[model samples]
Target: MAGIKENWVTGVGFGNFQKAYQIYEKEEMIFRAYVNHAHNEYLELAFEGGVIAAILMALYLFLLLIAFTKIRRDALQKTAFLSVVFLLVHSLADYPLRTAALAMTFAYMNAIIFHRGFAECRNQSPELVEVDHNGDKLFVPVGASP
Candidate 1:
């Protein structure tokens, strides 16, 4: 065990791989974590951050169930499910970062989707509103829009 730790610490045990990535996994992680393409880490971090942010936003949306009148609240629920689906698709399916930037991107996009949804609810007029008729209040019905 100690020898293993020493080997890892010194970066000494790595060797050739049967294929391109088979042997280079650790090196790739290091490269992704440090050196060039440093943006990869940032991108990954941003992806995670975006996930956390989405969760918080979803929580806020769910809290206002009664406020939105039936239709609007249902709409809010659908949007929340959309966000969850986005998170599910991203976290599962095991896609690579370079390949799955699409997922990260979609997560980011969903954040905007929900944010704008929240915003749209806020901007609506009283008569035209369903999920947000309270005005400036959070969680108003989210299904009343035509």
Candidate 2:
């Protein structure tokens, strides 16, 4: 077990897969399909971050669900949902959240969703009145033109 750990720590066991990723004209595998292969190296992020990665991933997914369900803006809600889906799917074969730019994007998306959700819920409806030039308050029908 100690030897295995040492080997992993030093990257002794993992080898370059240039051969594994070779292309054949006769086989004709598409780039899209090849990139989506189930056995790519998905361990870099998990191994580097250890248990924190799993915990944060779970938390992000939970927050994503809340954002999708609770956000009041239709466009923002749709955008958040699509973002979550894309990130989740992309995580399967790559640790997108590990890169600085992608991680910032993920954080930005979460901020928009959670902030908007909380803001909308807290400020549901407020009293408003219109004032005329004479400084008199005027009541206007909700749908009437001013």
Candidate 3:
């Protein structure tokens, strides 16, 4: 247990070091945090995970797109959008999704957005069909249809 905890702590420290190294690499090559050119955790993981990461990211994008367009309540829509932005911004610097606690929080936010979006879609009335004066078919709001 001690060994596992130490390893995780060291890994988190190393991950932060890689983020700092990327910033310093643009100006200098011998900075203290620069742990060679290969220690960047995010890039390394992306390379190692390959297609799995790509597919997961695609799904994440699709969820954001749907939530933004379909969420019925304005407040929930804004909250979900902000959470997505937060996850994206945080991921650029740290592996939040790789950490259990943070990952659970992310999953909760995603579930909320998806649930609300589906609920809104389900609640919408499908009785929008109408017959016009000349027997032509028309689509109008539920109460406005003749």
Candidate 4:
């Protein structure tokens, strides 16, 4: 909390978390080992990147959820969604995203969730027709089809 209060705008700069943690460490909380992270991913992000970064992260998660809702139902999609949920829950206790392998896996899940090609329109019906515009295809009501 002290770290956030002191550097809630631009943060202590990425990768300087260890040094900043030491500086912000409380006398009563002294430990033999150095503290590296805030433990909680969201808090760490806020402490390291400020409020804007935290908001951006929240927006990204919200958008990811929206994309997930739009994607076709499948085992892979279900697995990806479950994995993301687990990661999010785990983030409350530890910074799993800090690990490169986990981060890449998260990115892969996001790609799988956000790829429009993997989405199956729930509104598909004979009344709608697919139209292509500038190489992007979308379904529209027959009367509105180009």
Candidate 5:
């Protein structure tokens, strides 16, 4: 009984590494919370929901493509359009949080492509953005919403 109490007090003696102990405790808490919320048919319902969402997003994209004309001016407009599509897909797939990360990545690539002002881009790093252009100075303005 005493040994069990000591183990409980120190988070099962994984405290030598504080980060590991914290991670273990957090995982334990998450497990407990999930267990408390468990429903036997939840996974089946979630799976069906995901399938429906995928079909819906597909149909939506198909319709949008049908609506686009050759005279359409901006590719950025399409990027924003697809971004919204992916966002709805994310929500319909039951993950509303994932879209933000994906949108950041997609927007970064779009910035490197369109806003960088180059027919052929040269180099990029995790921390630095660079491009090689002939005469055009493509600058994306601050506080610009798209």
Candidate 6:
């Protein structure tokens, strides 16, 4: 909070969180181990890049919610929506987006949600194949037909 109070406009600059945190660390808390993040993603963003960054993140999330609502009927889209919900919920306790792998996964899911071809694919039912084995019949996607 002290860090944000001091740098609320433009922040201490990205990647400089540790330095800023050091300055704000209370003398009594100094015995504790150093922390590079605020433990909350939104507060971390505001601490690192200022209020504008936080606002931008909020706008991005709002847009994602709108997109999710528009395509929630599709199974794939529903999965994407769940992934986003997980990320948002997780952000309250950890900075998952700061991790490269998680960030890439988030980006990938967003790409899947926004891809133009997804809408077309959703409208087309998968071709199916009927298979017979041991006097039993089963149906599978055409891609798995044998």
Q: Write the per-residue lDDT of candidate 2 for residues 36-55, one digit (tens) a residue.
A: 22232244333333455546
Instruction: Report the lDDT tens digits of candidate 1 across residue range 1-146.
Output: 22223323232222211132233346435443333221332222223334443455457546433323332444554565566455544544333344466657555644544454565665786453335344654454435655
lDDT scores for all predictions?
A: 0.42, 0.53, 0.57, 0.80, 0.40, 0.84
Query: Over 4 Å off in model 2, which ranges?
Result: 1-42, 116-123, 130-137, 140-146
Which 10-residue window of candidate 5 scores lowest in summed lDDT? 36-45
> What would the per-residue lDDT of candidate 5 be over residues 15-114, giving only the tens digit for each residue?
2322333433444355432321112222222223344533554675575555443214456656655665565455543544334776586556434333
Instruction: List TM-score per model, in order.
Output: 0.27, 0.51, 0.48, 0.76, 0.25, 0.77
- Candidate 3 lDDT over 19-128, as tens digits, reads 53354345545656545324333453444344454466678788688767766556765686688679767777666677688788788877777675456555676667
Candidate 6 clashes between residue pairs 3 or more apart in a chain or in different chains: none
| lDDT (10s digit) by residue, model 6, range 44-137 | 8899899899889989888887787678457887797789789989999999999999999998888877776767765667787888978999
* CA error at residue 122 for candidate 6, angstroms: 4.9
Off by over 4 Å in 5: 1-30, 35-46, 49-54, 68-71, 74-76, 85-94, 97-146
Candidate 5 structure, TM-score to reference = 0.25
Which lDDT value does model 4 have at 2? 86
Over 4 Å off, model 6: 120-146
Ten residues in sequence with the least summed lDDT for candidate 6: 137-146
Point out the higher-scoring one by TM-score: 1 or 6.
6
Per-residue error at 86 for model 1, in Å? 4.6
TM-score ranking of the models:
6, 4, 2, 3, 1, 5
Better of 2 and 3 by TM-score: 2
Best by lDDT: 6
How much is 141 displaced in model 6, in angstroms? 18
